[model samples]
Target: MLGPDPRTTLVWALLLDWLGQLLILALIVWIPPALDWSIGGTQLAGQYPWILFCVLLYPLLGWLFGSYTVLHWRRLPMLVLIQRLLLTAAATLAAVAIARWLINPGEEVWLVYRRVQVVWLVSLSGWSLLVRLGLRQGMLLPDTPRLLLLAGDEERDRVLQAWRRVPQRERLRPIQPQQLEAELSRLDVAMVLTLSPKIHRDPALRSVFQHLETADPRWIRVVSPERLFEAMQERLPPALLAEQGLNYDDLPWAVTFSIQAQLKRAADFLVAALLLLLTSPLIALAALLIWWDDRGPIFYVQERSGWLGRPFTVLKLRTMAVQSPGSPATWTQLGDRRITRVGGWLRRVRLDELPQLLNVLNGEMSLIGPRPERPELEEELEQHIPHYRKRHWMRPGLSGWAQVCAPYASSIEDSDLKLSYDLYYLRHFSTWLDLMILFRTIKTVLKAGGR
Candidate 1:
């Protein structure tokens, strides 16, 4: 059992998935033609060739959605892949249905082949599942050694203990701080994972890189111990990277801000538009519900701090009972008396903010940025948190880097750390990075990260 190579495994999985889809498509497309039997009386129509085009799409979708990443196969992640398979199957069904409707629309075909359409969907879903499962299982056979070094002894021991509890401990070897230099020389290790910040700063340990270069370069395996564990990771942005010895303030701020902001806003407009379109029905339904509740305005607009301390009215469906009472801006509590039943659900799933799409469209917000806060909260926060106002340097977002990384911000400390992530997004904005944040936000919304 050879352990799967993370880099090459994705490529191979995609190829294999494509091959399986092609074979299944061929069988569906050709077998019907060969049989000369009308599939539910569609008469083996001219539209059968379109199945090839639809089949080619599934593999790319699967790869993009991470339906094929199984290099770190574990029970929970395997279950996640299975769920992705179900979604992929659903998407496949929708795509095929759309294709048929658009390109294969003949009343005779619809009338004759209604039942066969169901069969085709079932078969395609089954085929996709088989490929996904086969690829997942193929990775379970350990062929290569995955030696993960826990650089910090205390942190490493904790992880080592956890892995040992997993019955498959044979696949992992935890290297303590002292043994790191000696182990790197042996050179056949597939992964050298480090998760200890303490280990990263050690001058003696850093010198091991020189020794490793002297050894077999093919034995190249450098795992960021920092990436190996979540607790060890800092959420700081580049501007406040003084602790990490990085200084964004020293660099060209105007060029950096202009380019990054342009990319971020472009992404914001594209994503916000797509999301508004995709969820239009839901937004409509929510709007109707909100109006029915109080016969008041469905969309609530509140003044919130925006880029560079600019004030903007952030949009939301009125979730609170009072239009204006108590403080002008306050955080909604876990069980607030002001919340309606619908409001509670909205807060839970974060649907209340759907109207923010309008804000995004109006250029007041980005789809992904720092969450806009009340001016009152901003003034208070800036006093305590270092560089807290730095978050306002970019437009506030509907969903943000901090919202995905940290759980719902309730306390000042949580908000402060979240500000760090917001600054990070402003500094490192890109289309690809926005996609990553969107993916992370989905997981956060699903509560899949377990907070």
Candidate 2:
């Protein structure tokens, strides 16, 4: 807590950034008329927030992206900060474009928006780099924030004990009741951890909060412990579930039902279709090699668990020598003797799993999810491993968080390691996270790190 409050500085910085944008909006309206380049003579003022919305979205998006975090914002390099801000700007502009399309603004309105956006894109690019660089750097901003824990007398010890356990305890400056007003005036604390609901009942503290409502409420963010946990949620590994007091039952959606799910389905279908098409020639070549390698079948189909514990036949290019009837379903060992020469190469390149794209298209799998297991093996795993069936909560995928993040699982201990990543994925399923897995899968395949 020795330097500028990054969150407070961020607020001041963004206020300045937004003011520049507002001024730019005004100039776009004024400059055209002054230079006699007028188109329909300025209706931007009349458009209100409709036209001003994009300018406003700039800071809101920044907050959403945590561009101004309590700790890391000050330490972020100029290039990294610019990259984050640019992403926010891109998202804002995309919203603007979508809004314009949806509204179908008339010719003059459309022209005004297009011109303003073009100018904004060009000008703001230079603005952040030059004009706002110092502000974002927070070199000129004032005050170092203390981490405040708001607890009544009864709960103060409990709160302090909990606070001491967190790594951020170094930032706790311990503001006494009398010094609260002074701290507020100096903007010395940006976050208040309310450990007790009734702790804010003091007449002075209540007045301070009421003042916050009237003044800039951005400075002091009131955070309940639950809200803090919720913010920290989304990507909890199975290993940490006990520590976090969470269990497999906490993961929502027996079968995920939402727009996010539908979008995921659409993306899986489209990406799988495209990948299947693009890799057809490679798949054919691999199939021919596998046939020639051992005179075995090109495709191997096996019963595997799917979403909601449903059993489905999964398709894959055979990469193992044919097994005898009634052979136990066992994990293939590294450098297993059963793997044919060409099959080993196929596994190494992950080309053997290419046929699973058909499974993805058939809605039995996803482009990214927990890797499914053979039903026989899955039953054994369920018997021995806690929460093993939870992996089947989401649809099986050709590649997944577990598949990419973890190495090949031939042992129960290895499966446990992979399951942790799989649980993390289930906890934090999002479009962005799915895209991350997809990229990692591509990298793995490129590195021939498969099997």
Candidate 3:
């Protein structure tokens, strides 16, 4: 798989982007009219209708600017994206200006002279930029090449050579077959993009992979150089095939849910509300301890990758000191030094994450689903973890099936396996499954399973 398939992500992103633009436009429409404040008095009174035309123009400009496509490969070069956005805004404004002149021929030319369209253009561009940039940076951390052990050295070299021509090939590490199993055991290998043509002849590799399947189902098992390639390519349609960087497994939600999405939303709201009410006391205590231990703010509100790859601020009790800021959007570990004494206890009891209930209430997360991750981490994982970004289809959660089933994940490989459990949850997300997870989460908390 090239990366995370983002079809569903694209749909939701476009919807939200358009919705946000409409809201801003609506506000502009009502605010000035409500105040009875005309923009230049006479001619501008009902003439403000053109503002709506300008407003509608902005999001269309954004779409053309590639705002919708930024999340496709996890991170597009920021400068390049910005440049495209600016150019698109300019073109869109020009088009709008032409249309305005064509429609309202004889209106006072002085009124049109204000160039107030710049306000809509700049504001819309800025807002869209922030949404895209914040979202991209929030969910996807900087890309670090993952260590990959290709089981077929000859085929691996060929694939590596082919991909190396592309400049963004920093995300994969091709290693020899002899070193594969040990690396897999060490949890160092992000995936085994196996060109296992020799699988028919080599019982050894097959047996090793069988064991690996139990330990890490999320490991990439690519059979390079023949039938497997054709199988994968044939599966997807051509138009969809062009955006081929993402993987099949990336969209767990599409494969998982067969019913209406309303049920999931209702579950999230209800569960998040209930959890907030029930855990208020514990949350307060956790906040006090966090403040006392670190002499800083109680909550750590960092952006996490949410449903459809949108950025949402995830709430957690501050576990780290203010001085030692986290490596920009990295994953937490079992024994990270940034953890304060009280914070450590809070993590053990899973109390630190109580504040995520606020995120759930705000509709930024779900009650039970795949754990929302740092933006940077998600980007890195998508590079090596096949279908990694697919977990973003459903809203991220406070407690998840993967969180319960997997041990504390300290590395990318650990994350990959946890993804299997996450995919399982995405495939089987329902009320009963959520209840099961909730019940199990109670036991896990009592046992101090989190760290």
Candidate 4:
């Protein structure tokens, strides 16, 4: 149902969450004083720094943990509430630990700190849960603002099934052609028409939608069912690619050629340089381990496809024995015998990719984008997957949307799925998306589940 825009709902949810946290903090201070408890050498006003830290740190953690993502909000209210509470608790503990370490509170202050932190954690979690539950029930109630989906017989069932999976399903009612006008008039309706050549050419249906638009311009939308499926799955289907008139040659070069491209490159270089400096000791340790594994070379270098299908040498810490003279390139399977014990651990922790930061610094890759494929693999994928080569329109990346969302590709089908993620990234390329990918990538590494 077209209740509120997802982005608008997210903004409101965040506002309510922040306000709840603030109110809870205020209560923690006021209620304790009312109980005659000592505040340990500080007045309520003096606690502004802690309050400020909560204000900034909680929301940052929430965003990182997917609390602000709209898809989560579209789930069952109880599920969303539980997820938010857990995330809030985690964030609170982290913020409190960081604060304790940074401030190094004295004994008396430490007592006060522990007391306030416990109260804040409970109050904030409870309050945020109540706020989100209220929002879900009030604004996202499943009885108003109904959605009417229009599609051919073949497409209608697929579209209806998709809508049924969302929390708004109760408000989604499919209307037959004969009942369209009556239903539209009787309900607070938002109409979604699946785009197709046949539907586009139907003047009568066009007139009906045009009339609806005139009455409520923003309530009527034309969307491709395939695009909807792609979004839901986070992977482009071949049929959707064909239906949407997408072409490999139409790759969004504007993203690569624009001012943001310059900013992206600058960001890449600066972040790469900083990371390389910070990671120098770790890199040295990894190299030592590799060398000590079997007296083999410490670095592995191989040719890979890059921007605009150019070739560049990609570098990694050696993760396998030196190949026999004529061994062919192949995917790394799980528990492959080629992996040395030290190399396996390094790969798990993603230390092997630390060297690719140098590639970022060298302008051969981005800090975030589609991962570069090897030349032979790229050629094979391009042959099997439509528009696969379009991923090269931008610089390949150290970590990407596909890397975060999908497992490593081992076959043509897997490669196709990865390409869909790449296409999604290409279509929606932005600094914010890049940041999200980077955050998810960090989570993946911390869990030691390498792609």
Candidate 5:
């Protein structure tokens, strides 16, 4: 029943793309010399270094852009495919420009570099398109691993509808209650996606769950209806929290206090220090702008709930005017008149968040976790949202899964959705997942999609 893990699929796809690019580079180098056309009056031998540089850099950039992420390729949309190509080309060109300065290739070599860049852009784009098309048509690999669904009629229909929207829908096989035992005994099912509440309560089904767990601990996943919709939107699903007589102590908190927690803390400190040093000039510029605009305080400090629901002073570059007298705590909305002209640009590019790197370095926040909420909002949301306080199970972050996936939570409904994403992070916390969130955050900043 064991099959290729979804995580490794991305590595395989990346290797395939690199191979295709290598072939194109070889053709570009070999064919020109065979035809007696001197590329910028230099032999192809000298171009190998630059070609090798690109071969190494392309995959790194692809990974940075989430091009190699399994989620991206599993349901490859046309727009996402195009975005990957664009990011690849952009990264390649930027790498070339940086190399040109360092290598200081003379005028003759510079001409050759420009020519190769043009050819590479055209060939790589065409090759990438062909590879993606091949993957979509299933010409590059065998059929996807099949998912066995165990659920009641209503849940079965809902699960099927969700899977239908996924590009890998053909891999799912639904089993009826009467046929479940027989199918389990005979079929080589790799994964079981169940939505039936009975599986958690009924003695017989609970035994099945235990047997499956004994066979492969990760094989069976009890997903909630809300999780099903989240998956359809391509967001990671939160762990099912609705269980009979569930206790607060049953939550997955070991990860928050494990060796990985230590590693995350070290990373936050080191990375935050490095970023603060690198962005000092920009921070200075922002301060000057804020001061010039209204001569108000350049930094805003407020109390927010952090790890374990403890209060901490969070820092931010002021992005709004000084509050008028008697104004109450409120969420920043789109087109809010309180935003100064300079602050608007800072918020758009997320420059206002730079100061929080200090908080990260001080051990009060991590680079990736749930965004901290103000005390006023936190108190109100805790009263309205289920499991709202669970978000404090980990340190609050400067950028997180919810910030990247959902818009700013300005209402109760938005807060509910944001909590779901936060819980998903807590349930599935890992170094790889954190890296994905960081990359997505970069993409978001590049697109000016910040709040």
Candidate 6:
């Protein structure tokens, strides 16, 4: 059982969500006038632009809040999903209220009535979650892309298991080689997937490819499981990459050498310099709290492995009590006794990393990339995890693709999962991707979405 292409599902979900929310807003604005409710003598059309802005704003904020992401809706707990949707709506409302204050402060202009505000927020939240539920049940997109698996039994089972790990398997139909042409003839066969290159050996299937030049070929997209994972998850797993006879180094290694690297460096320096200026007061307050809590050193500096396995001294606000000499430092666990109360807050809101702006300025790290690991642990992790050393292929980051997408990694398995996302970022680092990481990082700070 395989679901439709991730790109297809994600696009459809976002478009539908925006359209549905737009309808909800339209009804709310129009119904007020129909009920003879006074709206500052402005016609409903006055609110049309506002409505369009909000409808667009929800999904944009939704992206930051992880309301809409790869696969959009599947296997996530419904409670967490609803919480994200409500958070997105609440943030959008706050933004709108701020705009209203600046635009026409302290007045019920353009659907700003307190009563209508409540209805608007509740209605949007309800409709957002309702759209998610519809996507979850596959009721919204009825015309799902159908997949046909072209492989032997063992290969077919491998493909099935891989899709199952994405946890979106229910539509992959495995057929005998003899049936390839018949399956291709079906209009619903949106993707033809195979695990082996020998698929062309079948003379019948061969004829289909030969005649595909004349037939409508766009309907039959050919992809392998590895390519499918790369497209769907946007990450190249070490094993899958190797299985395709590709080395990790064979990747388009553009992370540090491309023009994006030069642009990233300039952006990092300017942004970091400005952020250090703007955030200095906040950092001072945090440092005072750390010192007041336990009269300990206010900063922690450690040498961490960096770009291409070089080492750099990373600086961070001390989030744990200073230990005596020869004390074995350990990974900080949730609710660790070593963490002070203020330290826990700093970690939750990610203030502990503020000092790294200096590192970003110095070019030891990036504003977005794979996170650097402590040198003491980096070597061991490289031994245990496949392609783990690839993390040093580019500069580390203050907040990163791994930090945003993956849970805090405390074990080997967790490290592998994080490295997958990091590799994806390294492979596709660009301005837009950096902006996305920045947006999600902001969301994380707002929600204290991490430990």
TM-score of 1: 0.65
Per-model TM-score on C-alpha atoms: 0.65, 0.50, 0.45, 0.78, 0.76, 0.78
Each prediction's total of clashing residue pairs, residues at least 3 apart in sequence or on different chains, is 8, 0, 11, 0, 0, 3
- Model-by-model lDDT, in order? 0.62, 0.67, 0.62, 0.71, 0.72, 0.73
lDDT of 6: 0.73
* Candidate 4 per-residue lDDT over residues 1-451, each given as its tens digit: 2344455567777888788877776666576667887643335545566667777777767666665653344465567557766876776677777777888755544323666677666777777666666665656433234445566666566456544433342344555666767755653555554454445466778766676666554555555655554444445544346634565445444744667667788999999999999999999999999999899999998899999899999999998988987678888888889999889999887989999998998899999989988897777777788878778878999999889877778888778777878887887777888897988888667767783
lDDT of 6 at 238: 50
List where candidate 2 sits over 4 angstroms from the true fold.
Answer: 1-257
Per-residue lDDT tens digits of candidate 3, residues 231-335?
A: 221121111112443444544345556354567677778877897899899888888777777578888778888888898787678877775555566666767
Better of 1 and 6 by TM-score: 6
Best-to-worst order by lDDT is: 6, 5, 4, 2, 3, 1
Q: Give the least accurate 10-residue stretch of model 2, judged by summed lDDT.
A: 228-237
For 138-218, candidate 1 gives per-residue lDDT tens digits of 553334555566556575665555333323413456665667666665655554444455666678666665665565534
Query: Model 5, residue 105: what's the lDDT?
Result: 79
Per-residue lDDT of 213-249 in model 6, one digit per residue for the tens? 4556456566766666666666655544454344445
Question: Residue 132 lDDT in model 6?
Answer: 66
Rate residue 119 of model 4 by lDDT.
69
Task: Report the lDDT tens digits of candidate 5 across residue range 334-415.
Answer: 8889899999999888999999999998889999999999888888888876677778988999999888877888787678
Query: For all the candidates, what are their Cα RMSDs to the real structure?
Result: 6.7, 12.0, 22.3, 4.6, 5.1, 4.8
Better lDDT candidate (2, 4): 4
Model 5 misplaced regions, further than 4 Å: 1-9, 40-49, 59-87, 94-103, 107-112, 139-142, 145-193, 199-239, 243-257
